[model samples]
Target: MSFAALGLVPPPTFCKKRGIEGFRSHLSLCGVVVGDLVSTSVPRPPGPVPSMTPASRRGLISWAELDFRAYVFGAIRNERNEFTDAFIKQLRLRPDKFVVVSRSETDAGQWLELFGGDQDETFYQMRSRMFEAPMASFNNRPVGHGAWDNIRMGRDVLYSTGQAGEMDITGYLRKLETERNEGWLFWLKKDRFKVKYLLILDAQPNRSGIQLIQDVAWAAMCAAGYVRGAYSIQKYVKATDALLQAKITERLSWLPPSYALTFPVSNHHNALLKARYARYQA
Candidate 1:
């Protein structure tokens, strides 16, 4: 199913214009950047507009925690669109399992509490429990310093090996438990819980953001039953007149059929003037 099937559509303001080019033009006014050659073959589903609801209240059931950072960069480098397809397909198949999160949710404190370690458990203890959990019930447990340090050290050594490589080091580390590796043993207790999926949203479209997403994805994958799809939506901002420049410089390898929002940037002086004028009117 397409986004249209999920009740997404261009706003009514843009609906008055005909065809894809018109849609793109309208999107620019809102600061959304769409690839010039977007495919329009996908059909929009017909229905009355639904009432708006807060994302946090959506009550979507996620099996795993998705790292938005990784999902966006992965999509950028996804020349073949495979990554995009994997993401969208999951949404179509299990829309109820995904919830959109904002950039604020990426805060270290919140992430640590949710996925890493908080007051309740150490990072190693959390990892050990998650590894032991079953697929259907996997979720982030507490993370503490010792467990995280052990995993990080193993990852560093694997990367340093060059031959063993850093790629898929999380998966490799999971394998270490089978080998009874001294360092990993502490966090490899027999447990049955595991994480199923992670859905992250509003991640910044930058290198650091990409690393964050990758790190989250890797952490989830390290557990057993690593599912194929983790979806994310990255937010991009641009000045009103810089649409063309953005289109040229920021080439998305696979432009998935999705809604875009364009927030026009204004000079600081102009913004201040407008704010003052609004206050004066009030």
Candidate 2:
């Protein structure tokens, strides 16, 4: 559906005020017209509000903002290589589902500089932004200070992994990936699932632009992965585990039969039964 069909088209004066002539021109090239709107404000039909948990709300906010950033800046390219609009498409998300409140060039440029740069630079910057003071704290120290310092000081054991000692960052990440690819049922049974650690790992460059945007989004959703009030660790774990399952399921579906046999349906059922029995036993 078109923006006009959804009553999202802005009036000429509104577009002029926002200096969106360039965006309009770009949309025109895509065969989308924004000239039919007469009202200054877009009309919306009222509907019942959907229920959402705090973590879900935060995740949605993060996803929407990052999706908007990707949509706006996806066409830009530097001297090294040409960037493509591969984010939303990769995730199979509809572009119209996102509602961006601001489309200022300054905001887009700032986000691009923060996330679209070198991987190492992006990693540390995200660390400071998401895990350091002003964004998060526990007893006046950064919530992730212990883990961050351990990684920085080359300590083999990290706080995030609990009893999983003497493991480097690479090993820890590999373990997380293994659990994720095994599926959400496997992840639920693991004791080392920590939202803070997952956020830290999310900050690291692992995939494409989607990873960078998700890093920014997850940080924004719950800084340092700390939650209060009604938001619990279980809720955070479930939310993040859903994202992990989505990331891995795409590849799982295309695996060869030999590889597919590794994740048999019976194993999944057994895992579910074990989890339920464990919960009852507790």
Candidate 3:
């Protein structure tokens, strides 16, 4: 099912002007937060939108987290058109199961707490709750001043998880090396417990932000025996639907140098550890 099936339509105020050029400009405005954070312009001219080959598209889900209602209402109708059929065919996932995290819920603290709690909560439940959660006044800029949608969804949800230093896992996401704004997706397990794939749209993320996601993702993968004693890791970037896998060898400072990789601590936590170690040495 397409976004149309979801009965979600762009608001009346959606850009009145039509055509690819207008949508491209709207996409640029939608990326204001990202551009502001990274101090770079967004949505380079809408040249031919790239397409992903069948082989590269395998194992990826066609999903995106919901933007704040205001942005959703403002999205141009044409933007709702998705290239998810291939993504679904390859992954064999249902529309609901092929879910994206949403910006509709601002108070992700409670959701994170409950989900992170020891109590038994399935991924299905988490997805369901995210879909059902209420939307709030999350747009930083006034409507019409700047666009809000995909980029805003990722920014809002990630920041609300206390990734912005309010609670634990504090650090801001740095700009990825690409010019295009991204759509988010995931690769969840068949059991629907652990997250097997984290298809973030941004490349060249901040060191700390990448570290945070890596640590959490590694923890989950380790719990599920997805990683053997020694395993290699590869990074990828999505060009349109294409998943461009990279072949490079650069060790992350926080990650252990040994072949057997270990999780890294946050920069803040690492500093505390260093201080305590120095005091102990004294």
> Which candidate gets the maximum TM-score versus the true structure?
2
Instruction: Report the lDDT tens digits of candidate 1 across residue range 1-282.
Output: 012111234322322223333323323322222221211122332111222332233342212221111121011111224443443343334322222221122234323112222234221210110112122322333221122222222123212233343433332223433655544322322233221112232122112322333333322222212333342211011221243234323443244424222322222322333455567558
Which scores better on lDDT, 1 or 3? 1
lDDT of each: 0.26, 0.27, 0.23
lDDT string, candidate 3, 35-127, tens digits:
111111222321112122222244432222222111110111111123222222321222222222222122333232111211331212111
User: Could you report the Cα RMSD, in angstroms, for every candidate shown?
Assistant: 21.7, 24.0, 23.8
Candidate 1 off by > 4 Å: 1-147, 150-161, 164-237, 240-282
Superposed Cα deviation of residue 80, candidate 3 (Å): 3.9
Quality of model 2 by C-alpha lDDT: 0.27
lDDT: worst 10-residue window of model 3? 240-249
TM-score-best of 1 and 2: 2
Candidate 2: tens digits of C-alpha lDDT, residues 122-146: 2221111112123222233322222
Candidate 2: pairs in clash:
none
By TM-score, the better pick of 2 and 3 is: 2
Model 1 C-alpha RMSD vs. true structure (Å) is 21.7
